[model samples]
Target: MIVGIIGGGQLAQMLAMAGQPLGIRCLFLDPAPDACARTAGELLCGDYGDARLLDELARRATVVTYEFENVPEASLRRLASRVRVHPHPGALALARDRWHEKRLFADLGLSTPPFVAVDTRADLDRALAVTGWPAVLKTRTMGYDGKGQRVLRTPGDVDAAFAALSGTPLILEGFVAFDREVSLVAVRSADGDARFYPLTENVHRNGVLVQSRARPGDPMASRAEGYVGRLLAHLDYVGVLAVEFFQKGDMLLANEMAPRVHNSGHWTLEGAETSQFENHMRAVLGLPLGATHGLAPSGMVNFVGYLPEASAVLAVPGTHLHVYGKAARPGRKLGHATVRAPREGDVLDALARLRMLADAGGAG
Candidate 1:
């Protein structure tokens, strides 16, 4: 089987890695000459919206999947008419814009922080009037890892935010003072079979995911599953879907949803009975969904901005490192390490040991 992937980033690289044992050949469409995923698969170097390139990818792969939501909707729509695209272009379109995403949650009877669309100064003020102070102003499209967003703490910050983020479609969302952030990563096959991973508690630094701990049999697991169920049935979604939530006093408020495999679920590479990347491939191929059971208590710490020494990361007990083979820069995600153990305490200890290795800057 051949799979065509849009956006040749680390996620695509992982997908290609996961597909190899299944006799799945992966190919990628990316404009960047240096896209890291090229090492994993054949690359069709061209603009994302280039029709000639899209036609070539459609002709070559049995199915198409995208690594990120930012792929041009028109391009995908054009390609989908030629070859099958998993998760559907509609789902991709919904995930691309925050306003539509929040509205989908509302339509599905899921809870989300109050939000209002903003397109002008007057719209910003009106949205603020509805959401009040300490609200977040976010671009509706193309924002990730804390980029394209600003928090307005008071009335004083409103004009500046509007000035900075105006001239683009935006969303003003009420801040959720929640207990913690968690995510449920699930895969739904075309046959309607679905499996969900354990809920993961996530910690972020400057809006980038830094750490994630998978807690099996968590109390909030059922609630999170319910929300994801609605999403899967509604989208008739194929492949992995990750929904992030803000937990507050037993309530799970939907924060955002990723249509593809997610960063928080990276621990599943070593911790779960089947890795999410493999399950996603299975789902997209209309194969039976794999078990989502966690094999051990697991934690993943991302290596951002820079990488630690391979020997140091390997020295930590039960720690596995995955380097994306990308150049490091401030706020860039270069790699990650996953630690697993029989007990949660042991996992935490392993995580601590790995963190020390990462912090010490052990030989890069």
Candidate 2:
């Protein structure tokens, strides 16, 4: 089967790698000539909204999927008319807009941090009146890895934040005093077959993912599954969906959702019986889904901005390094390592060492 993927970034690279063993080939549409996924798949090298490129992708591939959520809606509509797109374009619309995502959560009986939509400076002031101080002012769309957002700690900081992010549609969210952040990575087929991987505990430094560990039987897994299941069913989603949550005691406050394979789910590479990438491909292809159970204690550390020598990373016990063939720069996601071991302590030990390596370069 041939799968056409939009946005040939590292996520597309990983998905292509996963599809290789399954006799699945990937065709990518990306504007950058040196898009990192080129090595793993055939890259079309064109703008996302290019009608000719979209037509080429639709003509060649059996199905299509996108890595990033912010793909232009018009492009998806044209492609969907010609070929199938998984997870549905509607899910992407909600994920790209923070306000709609939060409202969906509340409508679905899921908890969310108090938030208000902001279209103007006056709207910001009124939002702050309800959300109060220490709120976050964010552009409603196109924000990722901490970009397009500002944390307003006091009234004095509000004016400057508005000045910085005023040109786009915005959403003002109340600050959440969460205990810890966790994510659920689940897959659902078009036929409604679904599987849930273990909950993942994550750490973010400066809004970029730093590390993630699979918590197979964590007390919160069932609750997270329930919340994500509602979303999967409601959206008629096909393929993988990742929903992040803030755990406050016994509650899980919906943080945000990515309607695609997620960074936090990277541990699944070696941690689960079947990787998220493989399951996503199978789900979209209508193949029977694989088991999502954890095979061992596993964790992953991101190599943001810089990469250490391969020998240094491999020196760590139970570590497997995966580097996207991309030029490194400050705050860029360059690579990652999955730590898997028979014992949870061993996995944790390896992660601590990897964290030190990533931190040394100030990669965050």
Candidate achieving the largest lDDT: 2
What's the TM-score of each model vs. the native? 0.97, 0.99
Candidate 1 off by > 4 Å: 361-364
In candidate 1 the C-alpha lDDT for residue 326 amounts to 91
lDDT of 2 at 165: 97
Q: Model 1, residue 107: displacement in angstroms?
A: 0.8
The lDDT per prediction is 0.91, 0.94
Residue 99's C-alpha lDDT in candidate 2? 95
Q: Candidate 1 residues 245-339, lDDT tens each?
A: 99988788999999999999999999999999999998888778789999989999998887988998888878999999999877888899999
The window of 10 residues in a row where model 1 has the poorest summed lDDT is 355-364
- Evaluated at residue 55, the lDDT of candidate 2 is 98
Q: Write the per-residue lDDT of candidate 2 for residues 1-364, one digit (tens) a residue.
A: 8999999999999999999999999999999999999999999998999999999999999999999999999999999999999878999999999999999999999988899999999999999999987899999999999999999998899889999999999999999878999999999999998799999999998999999999989999888899999999999999999999999888789989999999999999989999999999999899999999999999999999988888999999999999998998899999999999999999999999999988788645
Give the best candidate by TM-score: 2
Candidate 2 similarity to native, TM-score:
0.99
Clashing pairs in 1: none
